[model samples]
Target: MEGTIKKLGQTEIYRGSRVHLVTETIQFPNGKRAEWELIQHPGAAAVIPVDADGKIIMVRQYRNATDGWTLEIPAGCLDHPGEDPLECACRELEEETGHQAKKMDFLYKFYSSIGICDEIIHIYVARDLVKTEQSLDEDEFVTVEHHSLDALLEMCFQGVIMDNKTISALLAYRYKYKL
Candidate 1:
């Protein structure tokens, strides 16, 4: 179990601001050799901010990868290696939605794309929100919106909320709060 797979070698194919692509040569436990195209990621944190009125704060922003707008929870990548995921969630919540959380409870973590990427996103439920000024990146243009938890869940089922992190986080929150 300890050394099931051995990395024989790896070649960096591309390096970008958020991710890097690499081709890895791996030796499996049964002596099978294979080449895997892996997308290296720094990880991220996502927050479902629930305010006093039982509404979840969300953001609608244009995603270049999809060439369209997406409704998603506040999320951001780890600013640097080893950064605390909870802190990142809190920062992203305020920066994206102009809301500061007094309490942040961890829900779960998952890989966004298990087949080709190693991007682990830590999800949390942020409660007791306080209003603040949003601090978005220079290129970020987001519209903050609040929706009922049930509505968000319906959106998830209706395929309106396509962001994996948002859908997962909303389901987790619903289970945790029985909403």
Candidate 2:
């Protein structure tokens, strides 16, 4: 069974330089129809940056949507229409954490919020870090934190870290690095 899109009634909530609002009407295979309000984002990139001693670099920031600050891996949205995900990940790691990775390995790609929006998040593991000045965006407010892979995994099990992308990244890191 497959659902088809019948009509899309998109109203521009805010025509900004980055994101836009779009709504659609989808007809399901069971003859059910529904409307989905989506914040059309150009996707994003998340980086699990590891330092020389193999500790992961993360960030703590306040998310307006969640109404509370959360601990998460370094991530940022695509700024250009055709920007490469890996490049975005590299940029975000540098901007948010003030570190650059000499080599970056791809981990996996997933959606941040699949129920309402279609934002694809690409995850990567960056190693061989070098410290530099953090270049944060004007609208972004964040602080960097470092954690061992073991401690991060513990946080995941303890429910202290509860973001999908972060969790996914951690799991991927575990399997990929054989941790």
Candidate 3:
């Protein structure tokens, strides 16, 4: 069974320069209806930059949503429309962590929340890092951190690292590389 979207009622619960509030009415196949509150976003890109020593260049940042500092991979949103995700990843990595990757590899894409919003996240891996100067976004507050592969994996198991995109990508990389 399937039903079409009869109507959507959304109000700006909160608005900011970057993101906005959204609430929509979704009608289901069985005449059931529900409301969804979503954060309107322009999608994002996460980069896992690896150093020559096989360590991952991560970041320690305060996430307002999480109410604390989180250890996460360098990531950023697409400010320019039609900009490539790989380019965004490379740029974010360099800007946030002061490292540029010689090789950028596309691993996979995922949705942060499929229930309400249409935000898609592209995950990429960057290797052969080169030291560079950070050029962080004006509104962004981030601190760079580098972690050994073993320590990073341990953090994942201990739930110390709380970024879902980073965790998923690291796991996938381990599985793919058979590490």
Could you say which candidate leads in TM-score? Answer: 1
- The segments of candidate 1 whose C-alpha lies over 4 angstroms from its true place after superposition are 1-3
Higher-ranked by TM-score: 2 or 3 = 2
- Which 10-residue window of candidate 2 scores lowest in summed lDDT? 1-10
Who wins the lDDT comparison?
A: 1
The candidates, ranked best first by TM-score, are: 1, 2, 3
lDDT of 2 by residue, 20-125 (tens): 8776776776667777788878999999998988889889998987898888999989887779999999999999999999999999998888886778999999
Clashing pairs in 2: none
TM-score of 3: 0.86
Model 1, CA-based lDDT: 0.92
lDDT of 3 by residue, 1-179 (tens): 55576645777688776677878786776777888898887788998888888888888888889999999988888875677888888888989999888888888999988876666889998998889998977867888877887788899999998788888988887887787
Error of 3 at 169 (Å): 1.4
lDDT of each: 0.92, 0.87, 0.84
Query: Compared with the true structure, what per-residue lDDT tens digits does model 1 show for residues 57-108?
Result: 8999999988999999999999988999998999999899998988999999
